[model samples]
Target chain A: MADHKTKASAKTSSPSGGEEAYVPPALANLIGYYLRIAQEASFQAIRQGTGKSDLKPGWYTLLTILSENPGVTPTELSKLCGRDRSTLTSTLNGLDARGLIARRRKAGDQRSYGVKLTAAGEAMLRKLQVIARAHDERLDAIVGKDKPLLMTLLRRIVDELGNGYPPPPARGLGKTSRTR
Target chain B: MADHKTKASAKTSSPSGGEEAYVPPALANLIGYYLRIAQEASFQAIRQGTGKSDLKPGWYTLLTILSENPGVTPTELSKLCGRDRSTLTSTLNGLDARGLIARRRKAGDQRSYGVKLTAAGEAMLRKLQVIARAHDERLDAIVGKDKPLLMTLLRRIVDELGNGYPPPPARGLGKTSRTR
Candidate 1:
């Protein structure tokens, strides 16, 4: 077993006149490293701009989904978010406890519940959307006018990752179609 | 305050029956989301492939850095990784304890120490790199032939995000010197 407590000492004199050393660039460009840093920065900004008491990004996603769909079920929310059903359940529970959302049993199915935002939840989501928009703008500003291009490229990458292929062109308005 | 505990309960539901709820297309397209899912999948695979005891991604990075530049410093490592200096301190302590790296005082600098990987560290890095290559191949297979294009697009996004300009043209050839 690797020793869990050994500290690798320096091989040369410290640049700072003390013993603090640095790592190299080999690790810098790794995709995971970049993602972690970007995510952390975004999350920190969101937490600070909005009160920490509000919905986190995951929770906010659920709220946004419900708002758009009106009465989405928990299972649907799970699939949409790519979260396990178990994780969505707990996240929903937190939202319900905070009065940000409510889950009521569907008309016929005792096991299925329809989720929607409460008054407080709606207010919170509205406020959060404002913060999110501002944060996104800041992020866009950081990337400058190339934001659209960046978004397109990212979307292409994501689309490639999933099984779905890009859609074919819409039906018949071309010269051949008119002849037909 | 949000009930953190209740959030845990939401995770227990079954996910089989809900309609395909709408995910905000815009959110789905964000680079952050794809980067996150990809990283999560990679890390999970690493953990599973390595069993419970092999060095994880961060540790592998540290070792790689040490092997590449034998006398780097902890503060430099933290900066390169975008991790907090304090966090690097703890992680370095763990690596040092494991006898995979060594920390030695610089000849002239009293306050900074240089870091290097031990022979054990080199061997471990080689092993992990093999695993990582396999892992990356799996990911590429998951994404299909678009993997290269996806990586290229992601690299472009990072370049645009970290620096507000389009990437410079390939090395050694000025714009005027190139044949169109």
Candidate 2:
């Protein structure tokens, strides 16, 4: 750590000092502020955990979705994840290129298709499940009470916020380097 | 809504069907998972509430910190906010451009300087505090407990994560449009 600091200092400047965590007076209680902190923590954990994998940030969540909702279509997947379909496409393309997922057109509907986990995709998700479990355990240590109470609260916010937001048709063929 | 769908469909080919929110298998329990959902909600709420203001998603939080820790330097503010100084420069520059913040070097301390809320900065924060308060009240309605418990749990997670992440020095001069 000290060595890195010295190297970094040599490149530009000295270390920033006197950083007592300032819980922004009222911002801490604003729900959004805490949400950013917690989400950033989760993002970091995923980045660290999947550092060696080809999977992008938030792709594990997509894989988990495909694992649970096997045979789900891209549109369905988008709605399930609340991510725009344009966003889902690039992610889908990457996982597809890696042989982790397979896309199959529905028998009658040629334009739309179902997304399935290839054997490799399922295998990757299983490994991620373990890492995710560890992440959950770490959070469990902090949140306590198994998180149902907290989830219950968060779910309520999602429910109320979901109202009146139009679901859009997803654009096809976009780059999918999801950065969490 | 229909028009958006029509336009989107025209571009995308067809409507995607069957998007029930897929609860991520076993990950719904992770505090981070809940954190993403909760954060998205707060983000949407802020988008709705402050749609007219030039304040970007996170600038409000930065402003709140400066409001609380008046006369803090870039290094100290970086520490207080758990962000690298290099990351803070653009954000500081933006607020400074808006005439909401001021920075000055300390006597005998050429490198370190203090950041204070300009009267405009204070006034904007005061206005934002009201909007932020109303945002909190809506969340409080959803969380049902005014967030002491939730904030405490999240703070714990932030504290645990803060350790081991090296603080970097703030770069001298650059564009400071920090998105995350």
Best by the lDDT measure = 2
Residue-level lDDT tens digits of model 1 in A1-180: 111122233211111111111323553434444444455445544555554565576666767778877687877676776566677777777888898888888998888989999999999888777777776666666555655665554443334333212121222333332221
Error of 2 at B143 (Å): 2.2
- Check candidate 2 and list the clashing pairs: A90-A176, B85-B170, B90-B176
lDDT per prediction? 0.55, 0.68
Give per-residue CA lDDT, model 1, range B1-180, as digits (tens): 112123322221222212232347545644454444544444554555575665676677667766776787776655444444567777777777877788999889899898888887788889877776665555555545544554454444444343212222223333231110
**Per-residue lDDT for B153 in model 2?**
73
Worst 10 residues of 2 chain B by lDDT: B11-20
The residue-by-residue lDDT of candidate 2 on A1-180, one tens digit each, is 222233223332222222224577666566767777767766665666676666565677888888888988887787677656677888889899999999998999999999999999998888887777777777777777737777777777766654423332345433341212
Residue ranges of candidate 2 with Cα displaced over 4 Å: A1-4, A7-20, A164-180, B1-22, B165-180
Compute the TM-score of each model's chain A versus the native chain A and list the values: 0.70, 0.74
| DockQ of all models, two decimals each | 0.07, 0.29
